[model samples]
Target: MPLLGLVSEYLGFFALLAAIVLVWKDSPWQKGTKVAATIGAMALLGAVLPAPPEDGAATVTAEADGKAAGGGSAAGVLAPASPTAGTTPEPSPRPRPEAADYRGMTLDDARDRAEAAGFGVDEHDASDEDKSIMMRLNWTVCFQKTGWTSSGTKTIDFGAVKNGAPCPAADGGAIPWPTMPDLVWKTWKTAHQEVAALGTVPGDHIMASTAYLNDQLPDEGEYDDWRVCVTDPAEGGDVTVDLRVTLELTHPDNGCPDPDREDGDRPDLPDRDDDGDPDYRDPFPGDRNRTSAFPNGLTGGSDDSSDGNGGGGGDHWNCPRTRWC
Candidate 1:
C-alpha cells in the first residue's frame, strides 16, 4: 500500500510537472488550462474507479497448502517428486536475506550489506547530524535485529552510534587538565609516580629539573639528590594537559653549588678608557670624559654651566664642578 501510495503521488506530480515543462516555452493560457483540465478529469475518473480484488493472493496461498473448494489438491499445485505417503514440504521464496553476521563490520559496510539484503536501514544519535553524515563508517553499529515481517511489511532495527559522536569531548577529543598535585615536598620519583597516576607521562608531561630549566637545559640523565621545590602552578593549582611542566628542585641543604645564587662574583673585561671602571662594568666604557651616565642629574660628571652658582641643575649645593653633588 505504501509503495502504491508513492506511485500515485509520483504519477500525479510528474503529470503536473510534465505539463508545465512541455508548454513552458510557447505557453498560452489555452494550452496550459487544457492540460490541467485533462489531468484533473483523469484524476477524478481514477478516484471513482472500483478497487481490484485480492483473490489472486488468496488463490496462491491456497495452492501452496494443497487445498481446493472440494477438499482436493489445487489444480496448480504440483505433487512432490517422490511418490511417498508423506514427503517433506518445499520452502517458500527464502526469507528476505538475514541481517545476522553483520557484527564487527564498520557502520558503512554494515548498512550497505543490510540494505542490499532487503532490509531498510535506520540509525540513532541523529541529533548528532554531523556524526551521521560522516564517512558512513564513522560510528560502529553495535547491535542489529532482523525484525518481524507480515504480509509485505517488515521492520528492521539497527542500534548504531554505539561507538560515539564526532564532536570533541565525546571520544577524548578535548584535552583534560588534572589538578597540580602537592608534589612540592615529595621526592622526584614519588612526584613522577603521582603524575603518572593522574594520566600523564613523567618524561613527557612532567619534567624534573635541578634548579630551573631556563635557556640552558641540564643533562637529561641527572635527577639524583634533588627534591622538588616548585611546580609551575605550585600545589593545588590546575595546569594544562600534556604541557611539559618544569619540576624545579633545590639542592638538599645547599649540598651542591646553586647556579642561580648571586655570589657577588664579576666577569673580567678590558677598560679602554681606564677610568677606574672595567669595560663590562662601566656604563660608558669608551667615553673618557664620563665614567658613568646618570639621568635626572642624580650622580653624574659636574656640568660647568651650573658650577659655582650655588644653584645648578647638576649640583645640589655646588660642592665641586668636576665631581657629583
Candidate 2:
C-alpha cells in the first residue's frame, strides 16, 4: 500500500517535469546557462515533494479496473458501519462461551469454535498435511454475497504454508508460502469471485506472536488480526450490471488477551455473545453509502477451452472496475 501511493505521486511529478523540458528544447532556455538554471530549479522543487495522500482516508475507495477490489490496495475508504437513526438501544457487548475441548479436535472442530465465537471461516484445500493441521482452530468473520451464485470445491490457502510435518502450535508456529502464485495470481482468472486471504482482522492485534512466521504482519492467524473484504458481481442480461461485497475476519492463533499487557485483555473481541450464529448486517448495502468499491463486468475466453491459463482462469471471467481494460 505504501508503494502504491508513492509511485502514483512520483509518476505525476515526472510527467510534468518531462513536458516542460521537451517544450523548451530549442528555445533560449535550452542553451548552457538557461538549461542549467532550469534543471537546478526543477531539482530544488522536486526535493520539496509534497506528501502523498494517506491510504486509509475516507475518499479513496477500491475499484475493479485492472485489478481486484483491494488488489492494488491503496487503503483509504473505511468500510461503512450500521446506521443509527431511531432511539433503539445499542446491543450490549458479550463474551462467547468457553470452547468445548481440544482433545483430537479436527479442523472442523476448530472452525466451529471460532465461528461460534464470532469469527468467519474460509476453507482452502491445501496439501493433506497442511489442511489437516492448520485448519483445526482457525476461524474468521464472514458476510454473505447476494444474488445468483454457485458453490465449488477448490480453495486457495493464503495463510497456511506446508511445513513438512503438522503446523506448529498457534502461539509458536510458521506457515510458509509455496513458490508458486501467492495472493495476486490466485485471483488473476475470473472464475473465482471470492478473494480470501490469511491474516488478522483490521485493528484487533494486541498480543504479538512469539514465533515469527510473518513479522511484517501485525496480527495473528488469518482472521484474528487480519482484515479481508471480497466482491462477487452479478451478471446482467441488460445494459446495467450489479455487484456485492463481503467483509470477512478470521482468527488464526489461540493467544488469549493479557490484562497485564498495555492494551489490556479484550475477551470481548471475538464473538463475545455465545449466539452460535452470525449477525447479518449489510454495513454497505446501497443508499447512504452506495458507491461500492468492487467492479462488475463481462468476461470472455475461447469457446473451445481448457481449465488452466488460456481458458481465462476457469469457467468465468469478469473485468475489474479499477484494473481491467
Which candidate tops TM-score? Answer: 1
Per-residue C-alpha lDDT of model 1 across residues 1-325, encoded as one tens digit per residue? 2233346755655555555566655566587686776567557545644465489766676666657556877666754455567877676664644556765567788888777777777754322333434566655655565655665654455544433322233322332346778776666767777766765344566776554321122355454545776677666765643456767665454222242558623222356876654454355655554554431123334454655555554534443323443
Worst 10 residues of 1 by lDDT: 164-173
Off by over 4 Å in 1: 1-178, 210-218, 237-241, 254-325
RMSD in angstroms between candidate 2 and the native structure over all alpha carbons? 46.6
TM-score versus the correct structure, for each prediction: 0.26, 0.14
What is the C-alpha local distance difference test score of each model? 0.54, 0.34
Tens digits of per-residue lDDT, candidate 2, 16-124, equal 5665666577555546776676666566555555655567542333232323343664445345675688869876643333333322334455456546644444544
Best by lDDT: 1
